[model samples]
Target: MRGGFCSGGLLLLLLIAPAGAAGTERADRLAFEVPPGMAPAAVAGDETFQGGFTCRSDAGENSAGTTACRSWISPVLPLFVFRLAWHVDSVTAERVVTGIWIGRDGASEPLQEMSGLELRMAVPIENAGFELIDMDFDGHLDMRIVAGGTAGPNVLYRNWLWSVDEERFVDSAALDEIVSPEFDPETREIVSRWRSSAAEGGVDVYAWNDGVPVIVHREVDRFDGPARCIRTFYDRIDEELRETGTGSCG
Candidate 1:
């Protein structure tokens, strides 16, 4: 009688297993399926791997006779896989990213999407489309998307931080607005450099304050004349940036 009872219990559990799994699959599907209008541009082709993510792309010409491409990548996160999608335009043979989508990995549906982003290089989508880093000194990896860049190697990124409480990525407008930000994980500072011309530029060092960036120091360099240049130093005092000293441009 005990053996028969055990067999009945096992059969009941097996009978309910598929229904439970189906419910979970449906919930996930409703939560993270591809956005409606973007379904037509879904990437359909062979898959490739880039920067630890599986990627795919679909290319075609738009109405303007320019090559338009849609690409997506699946990057594994701590508890989930991050799926990213973007649009690219090839004009004069230069590809530029114009839109982006953030989604869960298993399905190609986007939970968030942005369009009309600043022009950024499109190919090598791993580096240009997205970046995973520890931005807030938190051990968890954060996210960044290429916003724009100069002709030089000065690339700018739109930053997003992973929120432990929220269990999702939250946008960091302060970090995103930094000019040519370079992260120093060791020093835990954000260094930014910008130039208006070949002879005019400045460097700013910032430290995180209450999850925001506050400028701590700066060095300005510009030509005073065709041959003479000046280098000025500034330090933060009482939340103000004050010139500390000046020297010859180095």
Candidate 2:
């Protein structure tokens, strides 16, 4: 499952061990990298191998609109990263928003949205057990945009988190009003907790367990609609990591 949010202005603070710290006990720090030849997937018919459909790009009046494409690769062991681009009529080209989900192979069912806005952004996917202590302790991550465009000053977006066991999304959560959230991996009983709000200004916290997110600690945040919190947990059934083929982004 995935945790945390990624945006242009959010400050991501990862806990790291001091210069010469020892093994395991030493604090684990967050790291990211982009491997060579990593590029967006090629558009085929109506689908892109990276899990994008109805993908199209527009370059205004300058050029013919092209297809939006994406590619995913694991730059680090167990951490998958992706890069995406939309070729709208050749001249009008842009990258997909940076936090959208592209594909999850044998991991979990893809998080689907009703809006046509593609869930093809790139974000870090780490194994559960990491904790993000808010530096401000406001119990939430800093303000950031997860997806969607802005209307004047306020932006519209959707935030999602899932707990996966094997290849199923056992639990999930989507928010239209939440700005940011932190994941606490250190908590033994409760693996992670998400703090969010409603359009009417109601705030709530949804909690879940580590390995068995869907089975245990199934709770929802009651604000307006059906409790909108989805949770899923992962177990270390397969410890070995495998790499997948690279996509050509022409």
Query: Compared with the true structure, what per-residue lDDT tens digits does model 2 show for residues 1-250?
Result: 2222111100001011234553223222111233455433433442212211122222223321122222231111122212122212222232223222323333332332122233222222111111112212122221112343333223333432322223211212333443333333333122223333431221122344342222222222333355443322222324322222221111
Model 2's alpha-carbon lDDT is 0.25
Tell me how candidate 1 scores on lDDT. Answer: 0.54
What is the Cα-based TM-score of model 2?
0.25
Itemize residue pairs with steric clashes in candidate 1: 33-109, 34-109
Worst 10 residues of 2 by lDDT: 6-15
Tens-digit lDDT track of model 1 for 121-160: 5465453455665666655556776776674545667888
User: TM-score for every candidate vs. truth?
Assistant: 0.61, 0.25
Off by over 4 Å in 2: 1-79, 86-116, 119-145, 149-179, 184-203, 209-250
Top candidate on TM-score is: 1
The lDDT per prediction is 0.54, 0.25
